[model samples]
Target: MNSMDVVRVLARYRFSYTNEISLQDQIEAVFKYNQIPYKREHRLSDSDIVDFYIDGVAIEIKIKGHPVAVYQQCVRYGSHDSVKEVLLVSAKNFALPDVIGSKPAYVYFLSAL
Candidate 1:
């Protein structure tokens, strides 16, 4: 599906959660609706985990204005040897540097990239 379709799905999920849904859940719901296969990382003590992994690509979903720590954590995960790519899907527009068109580990905005 196109990027706008992805954004629409995320917006729907955002509206469904009145009490603040986890970022991972929001991302997973979008992938689920699109039938994109993915696996969720599990952790007992962590408040955040890489939202989804699909075909070795780790995607971290965040709403606009999420803390800097969240972005850093996603960057860390994306830098791992096991991760082929890392994508940051944001709810609002933001600037991102070019990644040489790499398959994974590059950040992307939901509506723009």
Candidate 2:
């Protein structure tokens, strides 16, 4: 599928009613609901394992506080050859970092999700 398809699946999760649950688990349920197969803790490389691998995109969840450290993770995952894009999801809203470089990276704040 395409990136927009992934976006739609994520958007569906935003309107879901699973409160007090982790965004990571909510994302998984979204995939299951959409019948979109995904891998959890996917091994991108020997040194890296992302939270979720949906199609060619690497989705890393960071709910618990948005720190600059999370962006560091997005960059690291974006660098992997196996991943064509990276989506950084967080419970707290955070602005994308400047100089995140030319990677197909996107950020989502889960407060509305």
Candidate 3:
């Protein structure tokens, strides 16, 4: 699926996460429910490991932490050759640029869903 398709699929999910791990589990369920193919803990490099991967999109799940750190992490993920975009799933809302390293970046806020 494309970036927007991924976002729409995730937006339909009703998140009930208590932590990062739970959020990941909920995301996995959403993918399964939608019959979307994905990989968990996909390693982009020695230092970059994404929470999930679908097609050319790298998915990251974050329940807490600094937004800059998350953005930096997504930027690193976007640099990978296999990734065409980055999808950030967070429990809270934060500003993230639409593009990072020429790859599109999209965010799905759990609270907004």
**Best-matching candidate per TM-score:** 3
lDDT of candidate 2? 0.71
Q: Against the true structure, candidate 3 has what lDDT?
A: 0.85
Candidate 2 residues lying further than 4 Å off, grouped into runs, are 14-21, 97-101
* Model 2 agreement with the true structure over 10-96: per-residue lDDT tens digits: 765554434434556777888888888899889988878898888778877765554777777778887777787777766667666
Q: Across residues 1-113, which tens digit of lDDT does each residue of candidate 3 receive?
A: 87789888876667776788977888898788878999999989899999999998998988888988888898899899999999887787866799999988988877833
| Predicted candidate 1 versus true structure: per-residue lDDT over 7-92, tens digit per residue | 45555544333222455565676778878666777331244456666665665665665446655666566555556655667655
Per-candidate TM equals: 0.55, 0.78, 0.93
Model 2 root mean square deviation, Cα atoms = 3.0
Candidate 1 lDDT score relative to the true structure? 0.54
Q: Which residues of candidate 1, in runs, are more than 4 Å off? A: 1-27, 42-48, 100-107, 110-113
How far in Å is the alpha carbon of 40 misplaced in model 2? Answer: 0.7
